[model samples]
Target chain A: MLSVVILGTGNVAFHLAKVLSSNNSVELLQVYGRNKTKLQAFEPFCDTTDNLGKLAAAAIYLVAVSDGAITALTQQLAGLDGVVAHTSGAVSLEVIDHPRPGVFYPLQTFTRDKKIPFAEVPICLEARHPNDLRLLAQLAGKLSGAVHRIDSAQRRQLHLAAIWVNNFTNHLLYIGQQLCEEKGLSFSLLQPLIQETVDKIQQLSPKEAQTGPARRRDVQTIQTHLDILEAPLQKKIYQLLSESIKSTYEKEL
Target chain B: MLSVVILGTGNVAFHLAKVLSSNNSVELLQVYGRNKTKLQAFEPFCDTTDNLGKLAAAAIYLVAVSDGAITALTQQLAGLDGVVAHTSGAVSLEVIDHPRPGVFYPLQTFTRDKKIPFAEVPICLEARHPNDLRLLAQLAGKLSGAVHRIDSAQRRQLHLAAIWVNNFTNHLLYIGQQLCEEKGLSFSLLQPLIQETVDKIQQLSPKEAQTGPARRRDVQTIQTHLDILEAPLQKKIYQLLSESIKSTYEKEL
Candidate 1:
């Protein structure tokens, strides 16, 4: 098994360490985090490190830190002889400023309790050299069936796209939950509709998948929906998104 | 099994009839629709009818017709002796234009092929009379584990909430997918994040569950995302939603 060291005790690091440990292709050499308590339970599972210097001992260092710290971490690991990579979708390869650096970003969100399988997650990879790139690709392939050589530019774009689809869309659901709560209704009613919205994209394009009055550009329904949203910011968001939907489908409609 | 007659053969009608037919509680007396082809497959399973007057035979009549024809369909079924209901969220009992009225709205998106368990769905009920309400509630209980009694006014609010959470957010996802496709990326890459955005709400409240630059109020990261949108409309959406997220988390941040 190829030996691996993962830095950070955040959700991704926690999950990646366990998953890599379970799989026969890789041996999780060390788990690192600044705060010892956060890495307490995990420490017994593998060799643990709090100091940055110890990270260089492994064949590969997976720096699963926050986006802001990735560059600094890479620079700190610059003298390390082995391959060093961060698991950030937003940051680029050149930003690494290290001897041999790349990205091993699993294109999935990680929660502390949720153990996401790497096999289903697409690993977006980039490297400075051909051999290192091939190595990263091979490592990603063991974890995931889906792997893509997304450049720094494309990775940035994916991060931005993720905000729209994940972050923004989640807030919209929050608004719905707020609206429902205000009217003495549970947010659970919206789950089925949410499932359909997702299922629609499996076959239909997003444009064709769109439903409701906004896609139809029905002002009366939009007005009614606006009336229901008492919160000023929520109302503003509702109007702005409704306008966006209208303009997208109006020409085709 | 209660004798049930379902009006219309659209998505809702097709799914409801199938679910009800599976249950020992319901025997679909007839299915009425204009499209013979749509109703053809359902003939052997239930009594399929093109005639409106023939709906008088069932113990309970469920008009799953479009919002536009809801009033007209109820008016047509007004002469029938049994209790009658419409499967519409927005339309009121008074709008049904009937002497005996109720609502049997299954609060979920219905697709022809995907068969969700009736028990998993929340059925919203409202009736003109106590006995009628009791019967509708029983029928809804038979079909779903969760049943909500919402008035016409509250139901409208629920419908509007569905528009925000379901329709509008889906359009945003569509935008994200189109943006990705424009830059030569597949929509499937966004799936895990999408599912996570939804799954988080089961444990965390939406406000507490916020992630990304907007929640952090990281203007630099937000700007980086905006630069990649490329489309003018996409930029506007990104701006509006980001501002909304900032406002939601501003005090906490």
Candidate 2:
């Protein structure tokens, strides 16, 4: 069984602790957090501690804290014998000061309230040593069906690409919601279309799935939309994205 | 039974014909297309005609053609007794020169290859006359459960909003795919993250659902991403979107 200690009380830590503690293949030794109140949730599943120095002996130490907190936490974990890993996409594995610095980044967004299926989540594993890497991979396999041995450089690239797909894409939807509110239209009306847009990409490439005035270069429709948008920033964004799409297809044609 | 005739041979027309022909409450009279080759698909299902002059007698005529062709097609349907409507989000209902001009625009994007579930699609209906509107509504009800009586101006706004949510959103995903390809990473690695991004919005508002370096004002991560992006256009897009997001949250702070 994989003996794991979770460090932090945030969304990622909560999920990891919950999944690891319940798994037949895992023996969750402890969960550490600065706040005792946040540690209460992990108390029933594993040994909870507010002191980092009192962490239990385990095969793996997962630092599931924010990016800024990772470095400081890693310094405290330098004396630990276990594979010390940070569960971060943006941060490098080298941040961990332990001899066996590793990364166990689950490439999915985690929210406090939402209960995500851990099995479907893609866990990206990385470690300096081959034995630690294999152990990390085994732990990842127990948590998820999809496990990829991604290096620090590839992980950073994946994180950047994720921002485009998740962060910027969500912002675009927010813009659409604002437009709907302005027009006295229910945002729910666009829900099906929004869902279908994502669904199309499952089968077709994003370029092949793309449709609208921007891709087609329908000048009249484009002009009408620009005239309707009152916000200068929104109009500018519309113009820039449209120009980008137009140019992309123009080069191909 | 609502006797319906579908005009054109495109994605919209094909889907409309498939759904209408199968419904017991509707009699799909004829499918008219300028291209005889495209009309062959409708021959087994309904009466197919390449000549608009020999259009079948029906209670409602759905002109599911392109926005540019709607005006010209409607001019030919001026003599018809049926309530003539065009299935276009951008074009105005007044484009149809019939005594009863109507619109039955489906809010979802349609592709020739994808077989979308017609019952779930949100149909936006608009008509000048109450009788024609009722007739169109009944026809729409047989096809889809979700129907909104959206006016021309509101429809125009919805179309624009759709571009942001579907078209521009898909383009953002395309950019993400390009980044993955450049990094020698599988684009499929981002699939789960992309799905969760959309799924989160189903329960939460886009503003509440937003999570990223830009939203949190993590200048370090944003700068790292911008520096990594080699394309000038990609970098400009990243800066503009990040700036917009940063300013949005900054106002609240």
> What lDDT would each prediction earn against the true structure?
0.79, 0.90
Chain B TM for prediction 1: 0.93
State the lDDT of candidate 2 residue by residue for B63-136, as single tens digits: 98878888888898878898999999997888888888999999988887787888888899999999999999
Best by lDDT: 2
DockQ of each: 0.54, 0.80
| Error at A246, model 1, angstroms | 3.2
DockQ of 2: 0.80
Candidate 1: tens digits of C-alpha lDDT, residues A1-253: 5778888887779888888888887888888888889888577568887888777476678988887878877788867777788888877887777888888988876666655756778899998888888888878888899899988887877877788888888888888888788878878787877776776667666776666777656676677767766778777777777888888876786
lDDT, model 2, position B215 = 87
> A73-149 in candidate 2: lDDT tens per residue?
88888777899999989989887878998999998877766667778788999999999999999899998999999
Q: Which ten contiguous residues of candidate 2 chain A have the minimum total lDDT?
A: A109-118
Range of the 10 consecutive residues with the lowest summed lDDT in candidate 1 chain B: B108-117
Global Cα RMSD, each model: 3.2, 1.9
